[model samples]
Target chain A: MPDDSLSRMSLIEISGAIARREVSSMEVVRNNLEQLEEQGESLNCVARLFPEEALADAELADQELSSGNSRGPLHGVPLTHKDMFYRKGKISACGSKICEKYLPSVTATALLKLDQAGALDIGRLNMVEFAYGLTGHNEITGDVQNPLSLNHIPGGSSSGPAAAVGAFLSYGSLGSDTGGSIRFPASCCGLVGIKPTYGRVSRFGAMPLSFSLDHIGPLTRTVTDCALLTQIISGADTNDPTSLNHKKTDYLENIDSGINGIKIGIPATYFDEKVHPEVLREINKSRDVFRSLGANIVEIDLPDNFEVCNSMANIITASEGSSAHAKWLKEKPEDYGSQTRERLMSGLFFSSVDYLDALKLRNVILQEFLQDVFSKVDILHAPVVPIPVPTLAESDIQSNPGFIEYLMLLGHCTRPFDYLGLPAITVPAGQTDNGLPTGFQLVTPPLEEALLFQAARAYEKENSWFFPVLNDN
Target chain B: MSNQWSDFIERNIDVPEVKSALKSAKNHSDIKQNYICLVPFEAEPSGFSKVISTWKLKQEQTEDQNA
Candidate 1:
């Protein structure tokens, strides 16, 4: 295989090749490193690369695989993750000035799972500062540029993860989603990403932005790759039973069962209020693809929280996020980016009662959602972001005059599922008029991720992957 | 949002420390008051997991009945 073709293969495809000995893990790692060294700087998406460690591991993986040893499905596969997952003796800067020199003492449970599954961790990628901001603006590490176009923002906190996986630098990556971190970046970059049901994956040792809302999941080139990665990382983690106690299910068994007669709901309210015309056009096209796939797409009324869940999600994230950064915010406030500082400061002002009330209100919103929406449809389909890929100039919090509204606006569609702790996945809809791709979300009630994969698989089987054609610079 | 929360949220919003996130803080205060009345008296801050488990049980029971 040519170096570029090996780099372009999906996670599942590459792993299968490695299993068959058609390609060696070392060759794959070297191919990935070639791109990581060349295009990585231009895209501005890398936090740190571990070429030495990754190549050494890949050599060992090839040796072991030749001797008939395999760790798991991801064995000998190369991968990367957003900068926040803690790995002892490694600097997890988390795209912030506060932790620029911070060395973690423990490896995150999810990262450990990946290691045990025999995946090579080649690097940590750029992310929102402390995974707090939505758009990929991290002043500490320069802004993560969208791989498709330097002018557009790589929808973030999982910005680099999405960019790398979307650009095929790594077959897949693990990213945390508090609000839309994983899905938004996946949508903007035209990849498949899952923000698993909140408890589906263990969050122990990963950077905590919002303890309740944060979900550690994967972003990949296709639905099968996503299912494969999600299956490996998900299980009840004893160390994080408080947050990660959901039992794991075999995700791939019925993923190709197809969405025959599956009731996929198109929201009649709330979801379409601010969608871009071009994005809506693409969403309609996606609806057509689903219709052809034997899935029943029905217009269903989504339970309206009157933007109550929206504000409450903000409260919980800001409150918990601020609490996590309280000491640093007080003593080294200047270290944080302006937008990151401003957002954390807002968290301090919310009273204890207000925070408690937000938590209480969470269940109220969730129950209403279960009965009013999920009872009618196996999944709900909506646009990931209400607009096309934003230009960095437009989403720049320090420069954009509508920065506050922009922050809230972009997180609008994905925030509900984040706080509701439901399973939501983003699949590429199509490229908009501007040529930047966007995705539509398919959400299921908590713990119903298998259904989401089945539906997304049906759509993807009809639609080819929407990867960007990068010109050789 | 329930209508009975008019008397709530007497917290200080004019404080300069919050001026940076004034819009968000104020929005949270308003929304908190608007929605808190809807939370049943029996709800606890850590009860979210229980709520999901109960919801899942109910869903499974319904599916079993249908089957």
Candidate 2:
């Protein structure tokens, strides 16, 4: 196979090819490392490149596969993760200057799982400083450029993962989403991003930005690839107390099964208003595609408390984030970036009562969403961002005060899921007028990732939505 | 009326943009007035597996298969 073909093959395809000896593992890993060095510099997506380590690992993988010993399903597939996931005896900067030299003695459970599954670790991707900001601007490590257009932000916190995967620099990438980190970037760069139900995946080695809202998941080119990656990383871990205790089940069991009679809900009110006309039109087109696939699209009425839910989510995030950084905020305040420092400091002003009140209201609002929304529909469809992918200057909330509103507006549809701890996935629907990609989000009940994948697969197949390959412009 | 909130922001947070963002997030939500609902004894906080018992996607799928 050609290097370009091998570089862009799905994890499923790569795994099959390696198992059949059609393409050696070394070929796959070497192609990605070369692409990472050549293209990653200009994209500003690579935080650190590990060419020698990766090549040696790939040679080992090729030997193991040739010896008739398959490590796991993802055998010989090359993958990368956000800079925050710790690999033992290595530095995990967490995209901050204070942690520039901070090395963790323990490897994250997700990394261990992927390693056991025979995934080749490429290099750490860049991210927002401490995964706080939604837009892909990292003042310390530099911005992660959009694979589609260098001018726009590659929706952030997981900026590197989205850009790398979108540009075919890696087969798949893991990203952490506190707010809209994963989904926003996936939408911006046209990829499949899944924020698994809170606790569905373990956060053992991943750094916490907001203890209550932080989630770890994958960004891939296709829905089935997302399912495979999620299956590998999810399950209970003792290191993460918040990890859910559940039996392991195959996430890709019915992934290819079409959503023949699935009930997909479209919100009547909260998702429609204030949305850019082009974005809304594309989302409606996705709904039409689902309808044509023999699925029923119903207009579901959500509660009038979205603003309250968003506010409560912000309160909890600020409080928990502030608590997480209390030590560094007090000791090494000067080491922090101005944007992250300011955001963390804002948490100090919120009272414990405010935090607790928001926590309690979280139950009320969740019950409301469950009873009023999820009870009637299997999945709720909404827009990831109300507008098309914005330029770096347009979504720059730090310098532009007007863009501050975009912060809430960008996360308007996604933050509620984080607050509710539900599963949500973003599928690339189509591109906008300016040629940037647009994504439609489908949210499912907790632990129903299988249904989400099945529905998204149906959409992808019906629309024939192939992942767009980024060219050398 | 304004005690340590103003004092803390003035002393610790120096950036005008940071101060403004913080104040906006703090003052805008009004959680105390609107969202603070009295909890019933049977209900747990949302973060504490509040509605997991009611949502059984897996169970329902199994039942449908058996049927």
Candidate 3:
């Protein structure tokens, strides 16, 4: 197979091809490394490259396969992760100057699980400073360019993972979402991403932005690839007490299960008011696609006053995030990028009572949202962003009060889900008038990830991701 | 320290800590606190994961009953 062709294959496809000996592991690794060094520069998606290390691992993987020993499902398949996931003693900068040389004592459990599943770690991708920002603008490490158009924002915090997978530097990646980080970036890059149920995946070693809302999951070009990665890394972990204790659902097994009777909910009031007509146009098309797929589309009015969840979520996030960085904010105030430092500082403004109210309200709102929406349909679908993908220059929220509206608009569509602690997935729906790709988000009842994947797969079969055309362009 | 000070920061306006504080404070005011039953007596704060697990259990039992 051609080098780029090998790189373009989905994670599961690459795994199967490597197992079949059609393309050697070394060939796949080498191609990606070349792509990372040559064409990957303009995108600024990579923070560091482990060329020699990756190649040696790939060679070893090939030898093991040649000896008739398969490591596991992802055997020899290359993957990348957000820098926040530590591999003990390595520099997991997390797009912050404060941790430019900081080394972690323990490796993230998610990384350990991926290693056991036989994925080759290629490099750490760029992200917003400490995974705090929304537009992937890291003053510390430079911006991660959108794969579709380098000029547009690669929705961020999980900026690097989305860009890397979208650019074919890695077949898939692990990204953590606190408030729309994973879903936003993946949607911007026109890939599928899931912010699994809050406790569905382990957060044992990943850096904490907001403990209550943090979730780790996958981003990939195809829905099945996302499903496979989510499966391998999910399960109870002794190290993270909060990790879900439920039996793992084999996401890939019934992934192809037709959504024949699935009732998908479309918002009637909230999102329509916030979204641009062109962006709404794309999401409406996805709704129509679901309708044509023999699935029912029900109109859902967001549970009354549930919009307060967004503000309440903000209180919790600022309170928790401030606590996480309190020491750093005091000592190394100059170390943080202005944007990240200030975002952390906002947490100081929320009192303990405010934090408690947000926490208590979270349960009340979540129980209400589930009963109100899920009783009507199996899932809820909405636009990821109010407008088409914005250019990097316009989204510069650092001290430019003018661009603050862009930041608010982006968060309005995402923050509520984190507050509700439900599982949300974003899949490329179509492109907007500016020729930039836009995605629609589908939210499911807690622990209903399989249904989310099944529904997304049904959509994927009809409207494939928008990244392939980026290569042709 | 103040909402204006924090809001002056790059992204705080999006988070709007002051708005959240005031809204939550009003809901927690003494008058309504007595009447409104703020939370369930036995409920823990941020037991979202437990809620999800309970939800999953209910789903499974319902499926079994139908079968």
Candidate 4:
């Protein structure tokens, strides 16, 4: 295969090429590394590159594939991970200066599972400091530039992962979502991201921002790739007490089952309120395609406290993050970015009562929301962000005084699901008038990722929703 | 004047020293009243669910017409 072809191939396409022995894994890895060198500097997505280790793994995978010992779809796939996931002997700075040299002795369960499935890890991607902020600016790691527009923020926490995938430097990547970390960047970068049910994917060895709400999932070029990645990493792990015991289901098998008769809920109030006109138009267009797909569309209203979920997320994340970094904050206060340090320090102001109140309120809010929305529809659909991808300078923490408010607005649509522990996927819907990408989210009940994938794929097929830019290579 | 309550107050609000002083005040009710005001109460539940269900049914019917 041509070097450019291998470098630009999707994970699904790469698997087929490898399966047919048309290309060696080493060839693919080398192409990816070459692409990284050529295109990566502009994107600034990769924090570290492990070309030697990655090539070695690719050679081993090529040998296994030739010997009829293929490890499945991810086998020989070159991928990277968000910096928050620990990789033994590698720095997991989490885009923070405090742990710049820290390396965990163990690897994240998601990484281990992907490795076992034969995916080659090439590097660690940049992210928001300590995964606390959402606009993807990190003082310690420098800002990750969006591949599509150098000036626009990549939508972050999973900023580097999304940018890398969008730039085609890697086939797929693992990104954690505490409150829209995965979905925000994916939507901003015009990629697919799934934040699986809390505890559905084990969090063992992944850095924690909030133990109760953090979820690790995938960001990939296609919905099916996200489903495939989710399948390999999901299910119970003894190491993670919160991991679910639910039987793993085939996420990809039923993706094309069609959304005929599937009920899709559009929250009448939240979905329509505070939305940018362009974003709303794109969401409506996606809904039109769903209508053509024979799906039932319903307008459901979210519960009363849905808006408060962001505040709830802030209180819990701050309190827990403060506790987690209390030692670091006292000893290494100057090590953090101004915004990140301020955000972390604000946690100290949340009383224990306030933290516990937020936790209790979270349950109440989730229960009320599920009761109101889930009972009426199979899945909920909404615009992932109120506005299109903002310019990087617009989201700069230092320059933008209202950055926190704007970030909260972007997270507004997503954080509620995180608090509810539901499965949600963001798929490319269409583009704005200015030509930047826009996406809509599909959300399902906790542990119901298969349904979410099915709904997403159904909509994906009904419209030419996949970004043409992804094929620009 | 310093106590467990004082530490909790100091960490949560900016007035650590003042709050410590206030903790020893004979008229503690006024401070308690001020603190309670900051707590957010649940808003009156909106009947959004009912509106949503009706809207959903209407949307489905509309899609059916377009199909």
- Which prediction has more favorable TM-score, 3 or 4? 3
What TM-score against the true fold does each predicted structure earn?
Answer: 0.94, 0.94, 0.92, 0.87
> Which residues of candidate 4, in runs, are more than 4 Å off?
A399-401, A468-473, B1-67
What tens-digit string does per-residue lDDT give for candidate 3 at A1-473? 23777888888888998999999989999888888777678999888888888999999999999999987999998777898999887889889888889799999999899889999988888888888878899888899899889999999989988888888888898998888898998878888999998888999999999998889999999888889899999888999888878898888888888899889888887787888899888899999999999999888888765767656666677679989998888788788877676566657766676677678767776787878888789999988877888999878767443333355568788878987888999999988988888898999988889999999988988777464422210
**Where does model 3 exceed 4 Å of error?**
A402-405, A465-473, B1-43
Clashing pairs in 4: A151-A392, A152-A392, A153-A392, A298-B56, A299-B56, A300-B52
- Across residues B1-67, which tens digit of lDDT does each residue of candidate 1 receive? 3222112222434543344476668876886786677888889967788877777778778889999
- Report every candidate's CA lDDT: 0.84, 0.83, 0.82, 0.78
- Residue-level lDDT of model 1, residues A1-473, one tens digit each, is 23888898778778888988999999998888888878888878888988899999999999999899998777888888999998999999989878888899999988888899889888989998889777788888888888888889888989999888877787899999998999999999998999998788889989999897999999998888898889888878887875545556788889879888989899998878889899999999999989888888899886667467778889999899989988887688889888888788778778778888888888888888888888888899999988999898877866234566677888989988888898999999899888899899999988888888888887887786575322211
Off by over 4 Å in 2: A399-403, A466-473, B1-7, B10-18, B28-32, B38-47, B57-66
Candidate 1 TM-score for chain A: 0.96
lDDT of 4 by residue, A180-240 (tens): 9999899888899999987789999999998878999999888777888999999889999
> Where does candidate 1 chain B have its weakest 10-residue lDDT segment?
B1-10
Q: Which prediction has the highest lDDT against the true structure?
A: 1
Give the C-alpha miss distance for residue A411 in model 3, angstroms.
1.3
- Every model's DockQ: 0.40, 0.43, 0.21, 0.05
TM-score of 2: 0.94
